[model samples]
Target: MHPAPSVIFFTVFSGIGFGLLVFLGLDTFYVTGWTAFVFFAIAYLCAVGGLIASTFHLGHPERAMKAFTQWRSSWLSREGVCAVVALVLMGIYGAGVVFLQVHWAILGHLGALFSLLTVFTTSMIYTQLTTIPRWNSWLTPLMFMSFSLAGGALLSGNVGSATVLILVAALIQIVLWLRGDGALARSGTTLATATGLGHIGDVRAFEPPHTGTNYLLKEFAYVVGRKHSTKLRIISIVLFAVIPVALLVFAPFSHLLAALAVVSHVAGAFATRWLFFAEAEHVVGLYYGKR
Candidate 1:
């Protein structure tokens, strides 16, 4: 699948933002007054910024709101609705907390639940795509959930939870990558099956679809070389998991290290998200005989 920059930013940034909002709502870490203000500011910036970024992925950005009406079937639409609901609940709870220093415990909890659900719906958008074998896994949602919790913990200075969740996220990432690398082969999708030519011995693309790249080639048939992808997987692990965990282990003694850990984790997670999109092999590629 095409890893559009806007969609990548939306998923990575909003996942972290919503993750932070989730922890804030659950009162997972101590925050109040100016501290609460800063946390909420960061959360809203990431979440809302991500939502706005997604609009750029649309051909008609002005009509993006029409997506909200498809909540009954489309996971993308469900994600939009969930994001709005999460933001609204958090906004109401945040107004009091940031202004009057009121926790509004119930509202906070509800917002937190919705925020997590938003992430779930976002993951479903990808997982529901049977066409993309790499994304069609329970591990995708778990990975997203873990990244959210881990990133949220890092942002809120919850070292212990961050440490554990980072480990979980890293493990899931490793396993998913290993599993995803083989998914295309195991998917039972071939040019023959895809073109309804199984009765024959083989099927292949004898001629180019066009003299130049077209929309299908540019979008659904994007490919990353195996070696380059492997290198990126290592870089992503180091950035998203290893380095952050190491820095966080020392964060209790140094404020700067704590902040650096969060930065490293965020950067790492962004790389991870990029790889996620780049590595996906949309079954549509079978039609191009690239599978």
Candidate 2:
């Protein structure tokens, strides 16, 4: 599948934002009072900002309202609705934490549930795309959920716990990507299936679909060499997951290191996420002249 930078930023940035909200809600649940209100506010802002940034990817931003019309069948529509609901609930949750103070527990629980729902909605956006085999996995949602938790923990300044969780999530994502790649390499199934050809026999594209790249090719035909992808995977694991875990576990507690680890994880995760999109063999690519 082709990786849209806007979509990638949307997922990563919004995941972090929503993740932070989930953590803040959790903090309210266990730690009490309005101390976590500021964090919740930050979480809400990030979530909104990420959502807005994603709009830049649309060819017709004016038609964005049409997205909500297909919520019955479209995961993208559902994601939009879910995001709005999550934001609204977060607002109410924040209000309760600030003013009501009495229903923090109730609102916190609701926020956590919505956070999980938000992750599910995000995953569905990919998983429902039968055209993208790499994303059609139960692991996709888990990866999203794990990353959300991992990011939330990191942003919350609980480096030790976040590091452990992020590593676990990163390992899972790595395994899933490897499995998807192997499937693509073996059957030629990816490109074939994407083009609606079910046979296992050899297939190749001889003529180009267009003189210039179209939206589909630009968005889905992205390719990266296997060797480079492998190197990036290793780097991502180390920089985003393993090393951060080590630093959080062993290094002297310093805000700088914690902050750096977050930066590294975000950058590394973006790379990993890009690889996820690039390495994916879209069924559409077969029709577009890729073997």
lDDT of 1: 0.87
The digit string of per-residue lDDT tens for model 2 on 23-129 reads 76665334334665667766776677778888998889998988988888887888888777778777787777676664466666677778767877888887766
Local accuracy of candidate 1 as per-residue lDDT tens digits, 213-258:
8998888877765449878888889988888888877545487888
What TM-score against the true fold does each predicted structure earn? Answer: 0.96, 0.87
**What is residue 249's positional error in candidate 1, in angstroms?**
1.2
With candidate 2 superimposed using the best TM-score fit, by how many Å does residue 222's alpha carbon deviate from the native?
1.5
Candidate 2 all-Cα RMSD:
3.0
All models: lDDT? 0.87, 0.76
TM-score of predicted structure 1: 0.96
Candidate with best TM-score: 1
Which pairs clash in model 1? none
